[model samples]
Target: MIKCIPMIIKGVVQDFDNNACKEINLDSGNKIKLSLLTEDSVLRSLNSKEKVDLNLNQIVNFLYTVGQRWKNEEYNRRRTYIRELKKYLGYSDEMARLEANWIAMLLCSKSALYDIVNYDLGSIHVLDEWLPRGDCYVKAQAKGVSIHLLAGNVPLSGVTSILRAILTKNECIIKTSSSDPFTATALASSFIDVNAEHPITKSMSVMYWPHNEDMTLPQRIMNHADIVIAWGGEEAIKWAAKHSPPHADVLKFGPKKSLSIIEEPEDMEEAAMGVAHDICFYDQQACFSTQDVYYIGEHLPLFLSELEKQLDRYAKILPKGLKNFDEKAAFSLTEREGIFAGYDVKKGDNQAWLMIISPTNSSGNQPLSRSVYIHQVSDINEVLPFVNKNSTQTVSIYPWEASLKYRDKLAMSGAERIVESGMNNIFRVGGAHDSLSPLQYLVRFTSHERPFHYTTKDVAVEIEQTRYLEEDKFLVFVP
Candidate 1:
């Protein structure tokens, strides 16, 4: 069967044009025809500046309703999306279902959305109205059109990019990743399904062009962006940075590695379970996924045994996704190298998971398909040398309280986020992603200064600047 995905422009689904369509083959022997945008359509979308009159609450409410629909397992669109994920992306049945649940959770958490805005922008009302801050009224204004260059490794990332743009009130133009084009389009279709003419829906455009094939359209779109958000490997991030307008704000969610540190764990089973979840989820594709494990205390042998059991259990629960020939070959090579190096290696049945415990720090390639390298260290500080800001995004520590002791050092060493071993996927409110608040970059903070009649904090009486300067009284009010 063939699935035809149409381009969405300003809330309207475009008619499929054979001349402007790209067909992608799935591993399941099916095909997907994705609609492409032309130069004329791009200009029309750029010129159409329909204001989003809906308030923050209104947008949240609509998204919550859509989320409710997704929560229903029988929802037609939800079912189709999961089916396509299984077919096109080779996601297991359980993983596909989990992805849908995550989307629901993201949209249904209305309070979190409000909290995110308040935490990132100072106040929830900053987007809707100016709030008095210090001596002036301040508000965050959207930075016009936001261009999202999404990575397909994690579908939820694309959802997050689009959601952030909508929450910040910026118009969104998303270029779907070739590896997973269904997610963003499905999300946009849900918006249209809820209310086609809704401003939030109308404010979005989802289309795709190969990253390397067509430079003309991508460059033209990049030129119109007020902000460019790039999510993917180093090359993708560099392309977005190079092509984006010189004045545009470019936010990069580039490649970064994460690791776990287990020190004197009370319950070996519990700690093993948490570490397994971090490694198994997304098959180590996400930046927060754990790739290395550093054990600080004793019982290294016991923990390895527990970890192997947990990995086997998770393999049955969420089975690994399909890997191409190159990926399979790489996985085999890494295992062979570990064996040749005299390291302790434990693998699941049918290559479900691979674990290599090295006596020393190993610098081997991480063939990330539920593969992790473990290093046994005598002290926690020993891991510091390996942690650096330029590449480390997350450092999950077991025995939650251990974070209190090592968080400062980890932050200084370049870890962007610190969390409990199993909770890497749950990014709490008020936390900085990639060491910065992303919403801050999506909008401009504009301040309306208080009038001269308003008394200054230092000067009790209202005074004009000109009078103070002429009378040589400026220094008198300095205190």
Candidate 2:
């Protein structure tokens, strides 16, 4: 355990300021001090220089290399880091291992990284141009400087924003969360293991300060950023937005909840198993984790029973995460509500999992820890209004074909994405996120005009000739 958390400034570790540093363990048990670096020095360094300047090819290679270091068994950092997360944050071994696996899956592979590049900035130029332009050409460029206000519910958020910033060749400063502060350093260590002097390593700095109402360091950093990416609940997102000045572009990934819709045709047992997986994974802390399960079927009881069995099995495999007093009390309140409403309630001896089948109404605020709220609906449409288009993110459907049929309706209803059941959390880097090409939004584009390109008459003639030669292939650039 790092007793004194190191403060990173311009790729090197800096000493703790005796007057500024304060040590307090927020009951996480693996105690460490918060490295409260002074505002003046950090701001001076940020404004003084541009540390990153890698071309697209070099950026791709750099990330791929970092991934190899994490995946390679010889490296002690990845394994030790994951174990530390489990110990420090009270995550179950399975959950911790799963988190590690996700990192490897998402970042380690060359294909995934390339997928992101191609999907966002088409062909290193204009992508998916519905119409063609003859004179203009466009290319994506970094936004110069970025600040990421990361969320603590999951450690993955820290690395994800880092990847986007680096891939886009932007110099970035990551404000790490109190809950999972170690990931930023672990990622930097992984990069150092591969190539310490690489532009990405040199350009990135990760540090932390307590979230205070008075808006100090974070607000100043946000105000100066070219791009500010905030990941958190509604309140946190709002706070970040308030600090961000007009010139700074802000992207908010706020509190989102996902749900699954199961039809009667689907196998009840298999459906229950899928729901069990989503609920049990991450101990329900992840945004994509399922809280409300809406079923359109007659075998609700059978599905509920199978779900209980699966939860019982997973309880043994991935034991319940330790909870603080507040969390435990919240769980008790939800359980008592179920009992008071006469909803069928059940629990294993370990109390690692809880099931409230056929709850008449569920609290918008969920007790998200191995707990589930099942709602029986005669028609799937009954669940639509509750989805609350603004807040609801991913909606999983049972039958694969059904998703195809209901996709448009779901989109019209404000659902961001519709996927097959059990796969709401699994997404390709190139795939639409929050119904957007997220990478594209992080970048700015530079437009170029070829010298006196074709005249109006020449352009018309060129279009006709081009149409005759290859009608299907085309390109367009927005001026």
Candidate 3:
């Protein structure tokens, strides 16, 4: 069977002639056809006027309702989307379902959205109206058009990017990743399903063009952007940076790695389970997913044994996605290299998972499918040298209290986020991503200054400045 995925332009579905459509072969032997948008069509779509004007509360409510629909397992769109993921991306049933649940959680949590605005901009109302600040009324204005270059490894990332732009009241022009084009389209369809004419829905346009194939359309689109949010590996990030207009604000969510630190937990089983969850949640694909474990203190062998059991359990519960021949070869070679290097190697049956324990802080190419490297250290501080600011993202710590002791050092070492061993995937409210609040980059903070009649904090009165300058009284007024 062939599935035809259409582009969503300003809340309308667009279908092109068969000649303009490209067919993609999926890992499950299924096929999907995507219509390519012409330059004129995209330009026209971009020029279409925004249909409705809505406030923050209205947009949130609409998104919440859409989220409620997705929360239902039997919702037609949600079910179809999960099935499509399984068919097109080779995701296991459980994994696909998990992704749907995450989407529900992201949208339904309305407070988090408001909190993001408040935390980054100093007031949630800043987006809707000018709020009084010191000596001025400040407002956050949406940077006109936001162009998103999404990554495929994590579908929720693209959704988050679009949501941020919407929350800031910016027009969104999303370029979907070829590896996973269905997620953003499905999200836009859901918006249309809720209310086609809603301003938030009408402000979004989701489409795709092969990266680097023809630079004409991308260049034109980049030229029109007020801000650009780029996500993916180094190459993709570079491409976005290189093509973005000089006047546009570019935000990059590039490649990052995470790790775990076990500081002699009281319950080795529980600690091991947490670490295993971090390792298996996204199969080490997310930046927050644990790639290495630094075990401090004793019971290292017991922790490893328990981790193995937990990993086996996850294999049956949330089975991994399919790996191509090259991936399989890389996994096997990494395991062999560990053995050749005289490191302790442990693997699961049928290559379900692999763990390599090294005597020192040694590293190599990570196969990244439930593969973890463990290093033994006498103290947690020893892990600092391995943490690099430019590339380190989340550092998970066992025995939650241990975080307080090492968080300062970890932050100084370039770790962007610190979380409990099991909570790597859940980004809490008020936390910074990639060392910056993403919303801050999507909008411009404009301040309305107070009138001259407003008195200065230092001086008693605000008289004419020329009079003070002519009288040589500026020094007295400054005091």
lDDT scores for all predictions?
A: 0.89, 0.73, 0.87
Local lDDT at 398 for model 2? 81
- Can you tell me which runs of candidate 2 are displaced by over 4 Å? 125-134, 359-365, 451-453, 456-479
lDDT of 2 by residue, 1-479 (tens): 55666667656667777577657565456676767758754675466546466566677777777776677755688788777777777777777777776676656676677667777777543322222344666666678778888887877877788887877778878888877777887887677777777777777777787777445665666666888888988887987888778987888888888888888755766777777877877778777788888888788888888888888877887777778778877888888888887878887665677787764355633688878788899885787776767777888888777778767777888887777767866765556767667677777776666553354543433344456447653442111
Q: Better model by lDDT, 1 or 3?
A: 1
Preferred candidate (TM-score higher): 1 or 2? 1
lDDT of 1 by residue, 1-479 (tens): 57788888888888888789889876555678888778777886777665676678887888898899899999888999999898888899999999999999999999998998889988888889989999999988889899999999999999998888888888999999878889998999999888887889899898988767878877888898999999999999998988999999899999999999999798999999999999999999999999999999889999999999999999999898888777888899999999999888889998899999996556787899999999999987799988988799999999999999999899899999999999999899999999889999999989999987898778787767799888988876666
Model 1: per-residue Cα lDDT at residue 53: 69
Ranking by lDDT: 1, 3, 2
Best candidate, lDDT-wise? 1
What are the models' TM-scores? Answer: 0.97, 0.89, 0.97
lDDT of 1: 0.89
Q: What's the distance in Å from true for residue 428, model 2? A: 2.5
lDDT of 3 by residue, 226-335 (tens): 89999999999999999999999899999999999999989998899899999998778898899999999888999998999999998999898877677778899999
Worst 10 residues of 1 by lDDT: 45-54
Off by over 4 Å in 1: 25-30
